[model samples]
Target: MKRTVRNLLALTLVLAAGAAAKADEVLLQSAKSGLYVTVVNGTLAASAQDARQAVKLDTVRLEGNKIAFRDVRSGTYVRAGVGQGTMLATGSPHIRSWETFELDRTGRGEVALRSSQNGLYVRAGVGRGSHLAAVSERARDWETFRLVDVRNAGGHQDRPRPGQGNGNGNHNAGQGPDLSSLIGNYRITHVTADNGFLVPLGRELAGRARMSIEGRGNLSATAGCNSISARIAVENGRFQTRSQPMSTKMGCVIRGQSLVENRISQILTEARTVQRDGRIVTLRARNGAELLKLRRM
Candidate 1:
């Protein structure tokens, strides 16, 4: 009977089933606070229902019969140190030895991740400045997390539907919202200032700077440091601006605001795609990298 069962498991169909169960995206929900485990500011924290905080458990890269969890946002590994507990940092020589985890599954799709470095399980530390901590590996409720598929989770911007025109297939019949309708004050919410870096607009900057999309393909923007103006082109949901946005040479006391101003202008110059959902507008590169997210003010 054992030989028969082994032969059955070796079948191609059975192997395919096993492969399907292994690769998946899951949000590690803390058992204590009911918050999902996510990496924020290079530290592990429990986020309140944000699907962007999801991480993937790599089935490959086995560390002594274990796996590794990597943060989707920063492309960094979740690792632990002897006294530092768990943190999100790039895999370097100093941290190369501690990036693996042993996944322990429980009933109802819940799991516990054990640190391969110290043989401790990750515990959700609650409250302000609370980060994930590695403690003694034991049967504890605080160490377990529910694996939630991001598609089922709420509070995140839905991905654009598969279509070529204006993000929602408005170009199906060449009918879409008028470009003049986009003329208004908008607040910058997110910025992909450079390659591989996504920076959420700081509260100070978000309120100070505003983007004004003029009806005649002209842009009048305020970035706290200077007033900016430029001409932009839009056709069939594609967006582009000629040359760099010209900014008034005004000096500012707050250097941070000036930096944000420059960053926003840089993104607008390279804008390739535009999508609007109600009062929110998202701009993306030709390659679909999100350049900016703006909310109508």
Candidate 2:
């Protein structure tokens, strides 16, 4: 009964507007890594895949395009200091003094945050575990971040308190890994069916199968004779095909092409969980069953 009620509530949240009406806990995910903006000690950074206290800042208020955020746990406002590339939280009484940021929409689901005081935009830094800094004049790819709807992310993940070891032994968890690193080309190694059976592609579809996920959520793939393309949403290490992928209408010439295309389409549409271990990425179903495995090329 409890599980059913929880599921119903989750469904209702999804059916409602993407962001909460108040926009209090909305997630600001870096367009480059998909990691959300967070606070480390006192410095502002983008280093969290899951919603946590460090990443859960409140939008205290918004006046026109100027917005201000406050750390929910610490109650300190995110302020930009002079010559300070990194932002910080402060308890100073002047909340609007240096906490104002200008929001500019770059594209669908993306925005560039410019400091109202410094006139510089926020950059999500390059490579893994990069600290965020407000030092750019242009809204480049690293400067733009997507506003992820926190309600859709099953609430925030609990973060370790200050002075407490990051719960897990993985010290790098606090520093967000580049989940978008999966953007490069990958070669399909094997396909795991819904029934938990692993089917090797072998020669007919082994080396020929290729997939590339663009930064804009566009997916392009080739499996033997079929060419497939689709728009997919990769969020919080999971992906769902937004639309039915388009493919070449030509009939399959190879013996395994038809089966491969069907399987690939199914996997792409139903994949829910994504696990990346170094160069290997595994896409799994909602039931925790592996659906497809790929290796970075």
Candidate 3:
């Protein structure tokens, strides 16, 4: 009888341990973009491809059925911006009003995050640098996300060390490619849609479209209409740019120049990966769509 009681206690302890592990970490995937929430330079972005690259967040349950997301990478809690500021960032070390959120589970196996500070819904702003913000008045498709339990789903792994590969044949140690090699002038040679159809550029504008990657993460480009500049970063084999790129206010007189300028800006802001082959470089979106092709100048 004593032995049987000891076995029952052991089983209870094991089950409790499993439940605790399952309650801690989760990967939040956006239902709108189908991308995972990630942190880029202390800001919340939703663009990770898989669980390996997604930011692991500790789910802290509160008393009122609310929860807080603590980014394991930065050791900071996710905070919603104040009045007139909608951007969400991860820098709060403690749980505050802005750091707490309500997790509303949809009936369809998804959830929405509502900020406790402003009562706004968090949204995955896809084209706008894929940054997350808490400005939605209502929970829509963009505000819906899937909470993936790390322990049960087998999605959690120790981050790869600086010199070790993550079993994907990439030897960069998950730090992304060296940016120094990509610093130079590149002439825009081709633009393609998602369906592989070439987007025709005006003859005059096509000849002058150019981009320059300077040191210190500065990128400037011109599609023959106006010049645009933005700060960029590469993290975990992903390319990221500022949501709002600064641009010149010049009016376009060249035919199709405005369209091309807008297209180029969209491509740069939405770029997910950078691939180089000799004198050619390609920028692709998160959906594996080729956005831009350039030749070294």
**TM-score (all chains, Cα) for each model:** 0.48, 0.43, 0.47
Note the Cα lDDT for every prediction shown.
0.59, 0.63, 0.68
Q: Ten consecutive residues with minimal summed lDDT in candidate 1? A: 164-173
Q: What is the model-wide C-alpha lDDT for candidate 2?
A: 0.63
Clashing pairs in 3: none
Candidate numbers, best lDDT first, in rank order? 3, 2, 1
The number of the candidate with the highest TM-score is: 1
**Off by more than 4 A, model 2:** 1-22, 86-93, 126-129, 155-297
Query: What lDDT tens digits, residue by residue, belong to model 2 across residues 1-297?
Result: 998885675454333312434454666677887666654322445666555433455665454676666554444556666233444333333354366688899987798988776788878783244456667889989899877666766675655433432211122322323346668889988885433344678885787888888888788877768788998776666667888988887787777776777788888887665667677766754433356778888
Model 1, 1-297: lDDT tens digits are 987764563353233323433445556678766765543333455654445434433233342446655444334445665234444332222223366667788676778878766788877763353457777568377778877775677665434223211321122222323467678888877776533234687777777878888778888877577898888876656777865688888887765777777777787876666767679777764433456778999
Against the true structure, what is every candidate's RMSD? 11.6, 19.5, 14.8
Better of 1 and 3 by lDDT: 3
The better-scoring model by TM-score among 1 and 2 is: 1
Winner by lDDT: 3
What lDDT does model 1 reach? 0.59
lDDT of 3 at 244: 67
Report the alpha-carbon TM-score of model 1 versus the true structure.
0.48
